[model samples]
Target: MMAAFKVINQYWLISITLICSKILPISSETFHTRLSPSYFSQKLGKIGTKLIINGIDSHYRSFFARVQHLTTPGFCGAAILDSRFLITSANCVHSVKPQDIHIEIGDFSLQDVQMTIYDVQDIFIAPGFNLNNTPINDLAMIKTEEPIPDAHQISIGICDEEDYDMINYQKSVFGCCGMGSTNKDPFIKLIPQVLKEMHFRGTPMDESNPERFLPCREDNICTRPMIDGGSICNLDHGGPLYKFRCGSFEPECLYGVASYSKRKADRHFQTCNTGSFFTNLMYFHEWIALTFLQNSF
Candidate 1:
């Protein structure tokens, strides 16, 4: 069953998830032939109709990080925000101790794990956040045991009103990666088969759609794949939802962190074409900056 979590101003528990999909084998014909749409679908894979196909090292861009719970043997997706701080869902790390949390950056492949794991020194949750409530102020700033490398420039998510309206009106698609489990059973023993990339778009909640749910609440952003082949509800708990900047000259920008899915029909299982909800980064902008300012000083 999917975990039940609701953030109505107060903060609480839940996670965004990514599942391993079955991809067919590709060969020389795929590269040489002028293939059909179905061929490309098979090559790209129908599981997640996304920009970056899963498991391609070149496809990975900057600022992506993963949150691992050392005590629980589970992981959440996360992102680097600066040299000393990273961001993730507050609900994700809610009850965990600071020392038990580990953050991994500069790693594209979630498996064959690369780079040294950065241990967390302190975890900053939204000031108004309450562990007893739903995940409203659903963000967390993690201070690393040491500063990130000087060469790394973390992706800054869109928080200003101008960029927020631009992406929504433009119907921009965002990408996320997960090392989380699939909703299906027998998933317990499975390590993520490949680094999973899930696709979603920011959209208005249309309760009229009949196939989805409430879509989002006041502090949430609705994200869904354009087609029925994939689901955001199944991706990793703490993954970042990010988009490219307006031009080729610009870098990738993170905008949301996976929180919880607004389930349709109040059922634990997700239906086909269901939309998921994210902890809207802009909604927590003031808190984010304030947290950073207060701590940095």
Candidate 2:
């Protein structure tokens, strides 16, 4: 009887943790427009499949980290900025407390036992971050309690306006990886144990149709999957949007952070091929740098 009671208690604990993790403070004005990821996928259409439909397994990215709650697995993907700092979307940690979250790195698979997990020393959400808004300034920095081991410590690339513009206009192909839900079927939430990566093409601002694409503010960049039926969905949030050199599998520079996507007013289903918005990291480079300096021990 004691064992059975313990199992039931554990189950309830997990259920409550998941419920709390999903709660976010939203303004009434934006409530109708900005719904949860699952709702957005359901109202518009099916969310992407695979780790992104057709996404391939990424052995691992040394600089990538999984930012998640202690009880819930993960809500966002993050990029390591240095031995002590990492960056992700504000929405991922805005409502979370530093002591209640952890960072996982050096593991491609969620179930991998060799992954290193670290306690969060602090969390710094960007100024003027509004969860109800288009997740504007959707960036945050996390300081690890202890420096990550030297072997796994590396800086990720942050772009400047000039380079960002070039990539957008030149339509450079970039990639993102995460362990988000593989499929968006309302009845199913299929997240794989392995990290997955998919490539997307930069969608020039001029080419974006307001009628079809969500209202992408100046702080955001738009992208569409390189292939049909591909996209970054739930859990891909806060992951790096980065580029690679020709014929290279390694990431070269960071451009953006996966933010949010919305369906057209007239559309009933979410479509991965239409494109999605990412928080432009170049716009926040100065702020992030300043934050690093202020917090450096």
Candidate 3:
């Protein structure tokens, strides 16, 4: 009797696993690749100079100063609006103390640029952000002690009303930029690895309410490509998401800071693919204008 019971249990477990795999389908293989630490280090070395923040140093770009915490160490972020400010998800730094946050800029290989440490005077977390839901207001801003001159001149993308119409059901391509995780868990290995491909087509918008959920507009589509917590950015968080405009692709607007993923419903024990989300910056346009632009530094 005991032997028969064990066999039945094993059969059921395998059956369920197989069924779930089919429903999600593990995304497309054209999407996944495993990246080693050495490869990531090399990639960072190549792109590090372009990721300047506050004109202080090149090393500062390695990690977003505000988001790193004691528990999950060495997380990455991007500079959104030049060197002075960085836009990252609020969840990244949810546990970090304000005083502990530090920004590393300058040289990629550790010796070229001087590192500048800035005190975070204030942090603006978006309203109505739910840890469980991962709502639209997942955005946050980190204000540094001093402004880095020439940081504003760096090109950043802006959201336009036209994007809402163009993005719907169109073959839109988004580049997923960020550092890969060093954590190794058996379950995490199953999904299509995130680092191999930099960009992919946006998934079609499901028939869902736009007012409550994100990617609220037609042009404002969202992606679950890969690389969570890392901003979907070029060198910095405030980096632009370029759309093919006019005769050529231009960096017209900046979108949201990349945030956490929604878990798969069926897999109670395992995390689904790295379903990345970004905090929509459009919601806080007035606030940004008031605080960063109009207010005296």
User: For this target, which candidate reaches the highest TM-score against the unseen true structure?
Assistant: 2
TM-score on alpha carbons, each prediction = 0.71, 0.75, 0.54
What order do you get sorting by TM-score, best first?
A: 2, 1, 3
Write model 3 residue lDDT over 45-156, tens digit each, in one string.
3322222210111122222232343344444454446555666666555446656565544323343335455556556565555555444455566666676555655525
Candidate 1 residue-wise lDDT, 182-222, digit = tens: 44322333345445566555666734247544545667677
Assess candidate 3 and give its TM-score to the true structure: 0.54
Candidate 2 Cα outliers beyond 4 Å, as residue runs: 1-49, 71-74, 109-113, 151-153, 167-169, 206-216, 264-273
lDDT of 2 by residue, 99-214 (tens): 98998876674456377889999999988888863577888999999988773446676765666654343445677877776774423567787788776666655233554434
Model 2 has how many clashing residue pairs?
5
Ranking by lDDT, best first? 2, 1, 3
Against the correct fold, how does model 2 do in TM-score? 0.75
Separately for all candidates shown, the number of backbone clashes (residues 3 or more apart, or on different chains) is 12, 5, 25
* Alpha-carbon local distance difference test for all models: 0.58, 0.68, 0.40
Say which prediction, candidate 2 or candidate 3, comes out ahead on lDDT. Answer: 2
